[model samples]
Target: MPDAPLTDLQMKQAAERFGTPLYAYSAAELDAALSRVQAAFGDARIWYAMKANPNLTLLRRMQSAGVGFECVSLGELARAVKVEADGDHLLVNGPAKSDEEYRLGGDLGATFIVDRLGEVALLPPASRVLVRVNPGLSVSTHDHLATGAAHSKFGVRPDQLPDVLAALRSGGHTLRGLHLHVGSAIRDAGDFAAAFARVAELHTLTGPLEVLDVGGGWGLGADLHGIAARAKEAAASFGAVLWVEPGRYLVAQAGVLLTRVMGHKQTGRDFTLLDAGMTELLRPMLYGAAHPVQALWEGEATTSDLAGPACESGDLLGHDVTLPAGAVRGDLLALLEAGAYGAAMSSTYLTRPRPAEVLWDGTQWVTMRRRETAEDIWAAEV
Candidate 1:
């Protein structure tokens, strides 16, 4: 699915099988991502961030593989528990967790990564906690995704650790270890290594750390093997076992949002309308991301920009892109690099439904997540 690797015949087949505007994934690719991330971090524990791709099938695969779960909200918590992941391996992160969510996490025996002092102090006694430290280290990703700096509302500031931990300890909070995530899509492994050094210093300063999780963002290089190797080196000095939370690095390469050209029109410059809109995939409009588009069945590919079928002027999958030259009406197009945030963030805006999702199992395609329909939108209606 990465780079829209879905072939013309395959795209057409998928559209025919599951219907158009399908958000399909490759099971082989997803498994490969799991294998790569596991290989990168070495033998340490890995809690696949279920928020990345929470499709029941994906969760089932991760659960069966003995991976843990990382939840940011109560809903995510429920999703993990539904799969019956081992309680010991469940980790709850993110700031601003509701009181009920905290209670649920504690009752579920999932490790809670404490972000704020207020919640830490208010937490019930004997709470299992991992202090999420805002090292003031910058992840250098999009501001929306950066979460480790002091400005970030993510975790407790470094200066506040002493007082925060004192309260938790006094409250009988079970101190586990220190956790820090500089940011998302981290391009530099050295930055990660340096961040670990800072975390180690914290552990030494605080006492002994039982666990250390360097929240994973993608590494600098795009090469999967290189990415894994980099992650292994970054946590080399930490005495405690290391854990990583990778979402995009694990799923981005393995998925694509398959769309079809419903209508083609020429603007003063040139514009083509796609059946897939921002409602389905918003990375381009939201973050100006690069989702390499490919044409299946269309011979050599032509130089044509593919814009998502959204009314917004900024709704575009790619601009002035090149696929097969002969690609015309009904030609299936593949939007690569959609696996991470595609279906997870989709909406039913503009009255357009999201695509169905299928997983390629090497032998054949399996329906991992069924397509959404009109009934899906109103399923919760009174």
Candidate 2:
């Protein structure tokens, strides 16, 4: 992953000024990342997977850049609408379709990546839709992140493609395209090549296609150059426009999670306790993901376990984390590659209020989301 864009001093300043367990992103970094992908893909249409980060400030920035959004739920579409991203520029995608979601999908005229045959009926007649085909292939990634496997609950099985196509045609829905999203955080180019190749083969069975949404999950360390080439090839092979929904890759390295070492302990194993926990960022506990970590002050390298204040023992963020020898109480540690799923997936589990989120616009830190108070957490509770 790229180095944390925030400087050590800047991270420390944010921690001191805003408090620990904060998420700070760089607007400049986000722009640069978007520009890089746009330049690399050249003409392939790009859409921001709003599931990664739905902060209105970031969404407005994406909208200003002329990028579309791919929403997985009604709430995500609502968030995009709040940023003035509506019409054809938005896409509604997910496995299960709710009545309200289908209603909104048609009301907004947003493209739909239909995962099931039943969804075709749920959509408004003649509404634009793309069938998400399960390629019966799996990318070499974490199981929870894989979506294109034959048994995955994400898409329509390839064997059922013809039936789905016929269903779309008979139902009067506009079959705008086909989509295949194998998995998330794919590090190997071969995986993408295989998935795209399968989609291309399936294209032969379908009628004239206008869009090919090779769904996104490109990781921070994947081969973008090769992926870009494959995207071009897929677009050419299908004689249609290509759209990509890159989520983590575009924003993961642009933000950092700042947490302070509250204390140290040596129960069973050496542990450095921090104010942050699975509630602040769940990827560690959920997916066993490891983000690069470093302390503001440098010292001799010492391996230690890093954990959060959550009651669950599985709330550990990193096992055998190496940090500065003198890293002790009150030292700020910046967890890198947290821009994507960090605050976006945070929750009020254990009634722990969510942390604050800010963006650095080069001049200074601007608060995008304030820390949640107990009332903010309980307001919706009956």
Candidate 3:
């Protein structure tokens, strides 16, 4: 397992300077993660799934590192454009794409990931296309993360690929290749092997293609070499170049959510109240994600549920978390592996201001985004 990106003293410094409910990322860790993927994928094109952490600063870093951007919405496309990413470096993907998204993606000359047959007609004329294939294989992950499952509303079913391809070609669009993305946070290599095997079977129909995008969903601890080997074989079978879009795998372990302990209580379950909760980090309440927590102070160990300041009971961060018995108000707690979706999914619920973000570049702290103010939240309202 990888260590937390920020050091104890660094986290403490950030918390003190930026206030609690903050996000701090390590630049060194981000580079290391990108290097690992490049080393494993070797010649395969790497497109950073911007949804993981779409901060403009991070996006610029990725673009400078020669990583492409995989965008799912118009806003993401705009972000990619803001980074000055050309069509070659941008891949527009989504199950339900809006007209504006299509127009802008088309104008940018991005290769679109067609999810269904109907999308073939909706795409920009002569647009570059990669047909998303739904392998329909069960994967080892949260049900919500299993995008390629038989009934998930993500990709075209295996049986529907031929029709999709035919539609694209007849519509005068360029068919770049086939795309297979089983799910996110997948821990099992066999799940990938099976999905690749399923995709490999489509070679008889697809013939030789230009690119085969085996989408990324490797768990934080997943074996990249093993998964890359299978992905290589699948692309080889199709006689196409390999591409990967890694979202969380590259950024998740590089970020820490810094929140302060606000209070403690005991009602059947001992509770450690935090300044940050679902509004700041919703994975725990939404996907039941369990991030490792580390306390800065030292004392006797005690187990308690980490609760947030929300009025709802489901806003808990962790259950039965072990922390210092001497912890008190203003104490700091670091939530590890929060670099990916933590700030990207943050909301201004309860009209609370969102947290600020900083990046540790090994030399000094750089503020990436300022904390939202109460006035900023409703500034656009009439």
Predicted candidate 1 versus true structure: per-residue lDDT over 1-382, tens digit per residue: 2234455666677777887788877777778777877765677677777676777788888778887888888898888878777569798887788887878887888888888888876565587888888777766567766777668888888788898889887888788777777877666555665666566666545775567777777642445455445444444544566677777777777788888777666776466678887888887777666777766653664566677777888777777776666556777777887887888888888767667789877667898777777988878889
Worst 10 residues of 1 by lDDT: 219-228
Model 2 TM-score is 0.98
Residue 237, model 3, lDDT: 96
The sequence of per-residue lDDT tens digits that candidate 3 reaches over residues 30-110 is 999999999999999999999999999999999998999999999999999888999999999999999999999999999
Backbone Cα, N, C clashes tallied per candidate: 13, 0, 0
Best by lDDT: 3
Higher TM-score: candidate 1 or 3?
3
Question: Where does the lowest 10-residue lDDT sum fall in candidate 3?
Answer: 1-10
lDDT of 1 at 188: 58
lDDT of each: 0.74, 0.86, 0.93
Better by TM-score, candidate 2 or 1 = 2
lDDT of 2 by residue, 100-168 (tens): 888887888898888987777777768898889888886788888989887789898878888888988
Clashing pairs in 3: none
Candidate 2, position 341, lDDT:
89
Ranking by TM-score: 3, 2, 1
